[model samples]
Target: MTLHPIESGNFKLDGGAMFGVVPKSLWTRTNPADANNMIDMAARCLLIEDGDRLILIDTGMGDKQSEKFFGYYYMWGDHSLDASLAKAGFHRDDITDVFLTHLHFDHCGGCIINNPNGNGYLPAFKNAKFWTNENHWNWAVNPNAREKASFLKENILPMQDSGQLNFIKKTTKDSFQTSSELDFGIFFADGHTEKQMIPRIDYKGKTLVFAADLLPTAGHIPLPYVMGYDTRPLLTLDEKAQFLNEAADHNHYIFLEHDAHNEIITVQHTDKGVRLKDTYTFNQLFK
Candidate 1:
């Protein structure tokens, strides 16, 4: 099996919102903010090739929103989903499965695109089955007031409309094996968004986890660095504490999604609890 880190694009977000209640004095040290207080973030996704299946985890924000809509996020960078796929020797049609961590625009917007013929939106990955859990599918479609803005309809509804949407069965267990032969497992987290599925794959004698919004960056390794956007901040604290302890103990490499500078990181159980042990580029891990 081969894993590739796909660089979709970069955007800026308010540092305060990214690191909830955590004082700027602390988080700014790791993710320094610009003069406008917006920090650089990457819409980094992951692509996995195991035999006949080419599975993509998260799609990143697509270039479909109006300029006014995108201005709020401060989208930047030259990277794109199509170019990243080409670099990996693949195309949109090659993806057999799209495992969305959640339906947030930044994470799944690339799933759909405006038709070139001036028609309505269509699935970007025309032949792939879009995978999202039943709980999250419901949560996203009928988004609550707090999260409504993040779950854009154009980025989501088209998949179901195109008859390519498939729901992963809800599992009560912490981890459940996926239908794919890649031996992938889904770990569900509720603090960030209801039933956000974090993919855990056993690759090359090591466990690599797609650390979605649950752990957006290495700076979020601390238990208290929860996002202000989360509906339940207290629940996030508990979830982070439990997940970090296990990840540190098992030496799992976390694939960060929003961290612009750091792609992957491992944690160690320090006196201050779980702290980052080492950082690496995706290629560095294989070497």
Candidate 2:
């Protein structure tokens, strides 16, 4: 199996929102914010080439949204989904699966695009079977006031409408069916979003987990540093603590989705709590 780092691009988000109650002085050390207090975030997705299946983890923020809508995020970078795929010697048609961690615009927006003549939204990956959990789908479609803004309909409805949506109907603890030559597992996390699915893959005798929003960046390794965007901050704290312990115990490498600088990181159990031990890019781990 081969893994490709598909960098869609970088965007800025309020540092305070990203770090929650954590003071600026603390998070700024790792993810320094701009004059606007927004930190650089990467819509870093992963592409797994396993035999006949080429699975894409998540689509970055697509370019279909209106300028006004995108102005808020302040996306800045040359990387694009199409360009990244082209670099990997593939196209949208080559993707057999679109495994969405959740329906947040940044995570799934690139899954849909404007129709040829700008008629309506359409599936970006016409041939790929979009994968999302049933619970998360419902939560996103009928979003509560807290998360309504993040779950954009343009990024989601098209999948089901295109007859390509499939639910990984199983417990959050259910592992990916990697037994028969496929080496991957699905871990469900609810702290960031309801039933956000994090993919765990066996690569080069090491376990690599797609950290999704569960652990957006290495800076979040500190226990109390939770994102203010999360619906239930306390749940996030509990989830992070439990997951960090497991990652540290097993020496797993976390594939960060939003960390612009650090793509992968490993945590160690320190006297205070689980803290980042080393940071590396995804390719470094595979090498």
Candidate 3:
């Protein structure tokens, strides 16, 4: 099995919102803010080529939103979903499965796109099945007031409407194997959302966990560095503490999603609790 890091695009978000209650004096050291106080963020997704199945972890924000709509997020960079797929020697049609960690626009917006005439929407990955759990699907479609803005109907709905949406069965087990050689398990964390599924994959004798929003960047390694967007901040503390302990003990590599600079990182149990041990790009890992 081969894993590829797909660079979709970059955008800027308020550093304060990204870091939550954490003081700017602390987070700024790792993720510096611009004059407008927006921090650089990448919509980095993962692509797994295992035998006949090419699985994409998350689809970054697509370019379908209006300029006024995108103005809110300050989208930047030339990287695009289609361009990234081409670099990997694949196309959207080659993707057999699209495993979404969550339904936030920035994470799954690339799932659908405007049709040829630009009159309606269509599934971006014409032949692939969109994977999202039942709980998250329900939570997203019927979003609460706090998260309503992040879950846009244009970025979603089309998959279900296109008859390509599939739900992973809920299981009590922490991890389970999929139908391919790229077998992976799911780690559900509620602090971030109702049932945010973090894919834990066993690859090349090492375990790689897609950090998703749970640990957005190396700066978020500390237990208290939780995102302010999390609905349950207190619960996030416990989730991070437990996940970090296990990640450190097992020497698992974390694949960061929103970290524009750092792609992957490992943690070690220090006196101050789990801390960043090392950072690497996708190519550096094999070297």
Candidate 4:
């Protein structure tokens, strides 16, 4: 199996929102903020070429949203999913699966787009079977006030409306499905959002986990540093503690999706609990 780092796009978000209650004095050390207190973030998705199935983990925030909507998040780069796919010798049509970690706009907005010829929205990847768990699907469609803004209808309903949406059955709330059909295991996490699926792939004798929002960046390795966006911040503390401990003990490589600067990171047990051991660029490690 081969892995390609898909550079979806880059944007900046309020550092306070990204780090939650964590003080700016602390988060800025790792993810330094600009004068506006906005920190750089990447919609860095992953493409897995396992046999004929080219699975894309997330699509990033697509370009379909209006300028006013996008202005809220300071977008800053030239990377686009289509352009990145071409760099990897592929296209949207080559993706057999659109594996969404969650239905947040940043993660799945590129899954749908305004119909080029007409008005309504449609699935961007007409051939790909969009993957999202049943619980997450329901949670997204009927979003609560806390998360309603993040789950946009245009980016979501088109898949189900078009009959391409597929659900991965969860054995347990946080169980790891080792025998998944996607040729990789998934650890379903509920802390960030209900049933946010984190994919675990076995590559070259090492376990690489797509650390969706469960572990957004290496700076989040510190136990108390959790995102305010989390509906259940307390649950995240426990989930992160357990996951980071395991990652440290097993020497797993964490593939970060949101961090633009730190592509991949590993954690180790320290007196202060799980702390980042090192960081690696996608090419530095994958090459």
- Best-fitting candidate, measured by lDDT? 4
- Residue-level lDDT tens digits of model 4 in 1-287: 99999999999988999899999999999999999999999899999998879999999999999999999999997999999999999989989999999999999999998998878998889889999988899999999999999999899999999999998877654467763668688887788999888899888777999999998877888988998899999989988888898899999999999999899999999998889899999788868
- Sorted by lDDT (best first), the order is 4, 1, 3, 2
Alpha-carbon runs more than 4 Å astray in model 1: 173-182
What's the lDDT for all of these models? 0.90, 0.88, 0.90, 0.91
Per residue, candidate 1 scores C-alpha lDDT tens digits across 7-120 of 999999999999989999999999999999999999999999988889999999998888998899898889999999999999999999998999999999999999999888
User: What shift in Å separates residue 255 of candidate 4 from its native position after superposition?
Assistant: 0.5
Off by over 4 Å in 4: none
* Residue 267 C-alpha lDDT in model 3: 93
Show the lowest summed lDDT stretch of 10 residues, model 4.
172-181
Model 2: per-residue Cα lDDT over 9-122, one tens digit each: 899999999999899999999999889999989999999998999999999999998999999999887999999999999999999999988999999999999999969988
**In candidate 2, residue 266 scores what lDDT?**
92
Per-residue alpha-carbon lDDT of model 3 for 1-287, expressed as tens digits? Answer: 89999999999999999999999999999999999999999999999998888999999988888899889888887898899999989999999999999999999999988998968999989989899889899999999999999999988899899999998877565433352323687888889888888889888888999989999988898888989899999999988988899899999999999999999999998888999999999898854
Cα RMSD for predicted model 1 = 1.4
lDDT of 2 at 110: 96
Best by TM-score: 4
Q: Give the poorly placed runs of model 2, Cα more than 4 Å off.
A: 171-183
User: What lDDT is reached at residue 158 by model 3?
Assistant: 90
